[model samples]
Target: MVTYIARRIGAGLAILFVIAALGFVMLSINTDAVVRGILGPQASEEQAAALKADLGLDQSLPVQFIQWLGGVFRGDLGRSWFTNQDVNELIGLRLPISLSIVIVVLLVTLVVAVLLGLGSAYFGGWFDRATQILCILGFAIPGFLLALILVTVFGVYLGWAPVVGFTPITDSLPGWMRSVTLPTIALASHSVGAVAQQVRNAAFGVLNMDYVRTLRSRGIPEWRLVLVNVLRNSTVSGITVLGLQAVGLLGAVVLVDKIFAIPGIGEMTINYTVRGDRPAIMGLILVLTVLVIVINLLVDVFVSVLNPKVRTR
Candidate 1:
């Protein structure tokens, strides 16, 4: 287990290094833009030269990369060219909002989806069919459109939750939750449908397996068979789907954040991209790339640990 963990950590670091290198190249190679932005057109030739020298824009790519990597090692993701603030500081300030929102959203979807799915699978009839129809609609709706409808209907007309803006949790936890409730719900809505349906489908499929048939033939109690074996087997499929869906959630939350005016990582990323802020774009891309890669690696480890065949292989 220790060896496995070490291997994964090593691989993760290597992947991050690669991502950082690529992102730096993307940001650095745009020399013209960097020059123009850093030194306005009004600047004389000597002023531009001095600015380039101070910023190390004239340095070799290899030297700049080494310096950047060292900063990253020290948890200094460098300063954003546009914001002129430390990248790590910016991310740190916004991370809590996004992280907390994600947790709540995931909880809402997980609890609701699992209950509906398991119930639907265990008792296949009218209730199951109704949930199935709802699940289809859930998967069909675009995230942005869902946010718009929800904000317009729930926030604007109903006045149940705030229409926009995030409030610090330090001020009031209840008030903060009230503000972010819309964004989180919007983020979790589609996931609920997809996860619930997947769980239901997997559970139902497992119910028809040969082992289940044998258990029934042996006069085993229905409750034990369904609760233990059926649910366990079904999780393989359900969890797989859930994991994939989760990877995109960070990037996909932009529209939802816009609707609720949540100052989160997604909001920062989308806003920066819209403004064509290359440093912000490259930094965010690298951050997200590392996150996605780490998640995939964790998934691989999880699958290996869960399945004997995979571990041995």
Candidate 2:
């Protein structure tokens, strides 16, 4: 198990290095363009040269990359070209909002999907048909559109939750919950369907196994059989789907953030991209890449725990 974990961590680090190098190279390709975008076309050549030098863009690509990598190791993500604010500070302020929404969304998706999936598979009747229909609709509608509808209904008409702005959890837990509720539902809507389908399929297969029949014949309680035995075996697929969905949620949060006026990494990303801020953009990319790696590693560990064979493999 230790070896397996070490291998996964090593691979994750390799992926992070590759992604960072590629992102830096691509973003660094148009140094002149970035300078012009920041300083305006009316800026003189000397001004551009000065700006480039200040940003360390005058150095060779290899040298600049090495410097940037060293800074990253030392916990410095550099500063935004446009705002001159430290990239680390900017991301730190916004990352919590996005993470809060994502964490809540995952928890909700797990509980709801498990219930829906196991219930549909075990019952195999009207409930199953309803779950199938729900999954189809969930897939059909996009998360952003759902977010808009939620804002309109829950925020505008119902006035049940605030549609715009976020309150830090440090300030008030209830305020934070209210701030994140709609966004969480909007982001989780699609994931719930995907995970539920995976769980349902896995559970259905598990129920047909010989041991399950033996348990049933021995008059083991149906609830216990489904919840304890069937759910346990089916979890591997459900967990895999949920992990993939978590990564996707980061992207979807961009659109949701816009609709809801929540300041998060997604909002910062769009702002930096529009201005062609390479330092901030690269920093965001690196942070996001690390997040994906960490999430996948956790998923791998969870899968190995649930199925010991996976660790051996």
lDDT per prediction? 0.76, 0.93
Highest lDDT model number: 2
What does the lDDT read for residue 276 in candidate 2? 81
Give lDDT for model 1.
0.76
- Per-residue C-alpha lDDT of model 1 across residues 106-213, encoded as one tens digit per residue: 678777887788889988899899898888888788878888888999999999988988888899999988887877777877888988988898888888889899
Worst 10 residues of 1 by lDDT: 304-313
Off by over 4 Å in 2: none
lDDT of 2 by residue, 149-216 (tens): 99999999999999899999999999999999999988888999999999999999999999999999
Error of 2 at 128 (Å): 0.2
Clashes of each: 0, 0
Among all windows of 10 consecutive residues in model 2, the one with the lowest summed lDDT is: 25-34
- The candidate scoring highest on TM-score is 2
After TM-score superposition, the amount by which residue 146's alpha carbon in candidate 1 deviates from its true location, in angstroms, is 0.5
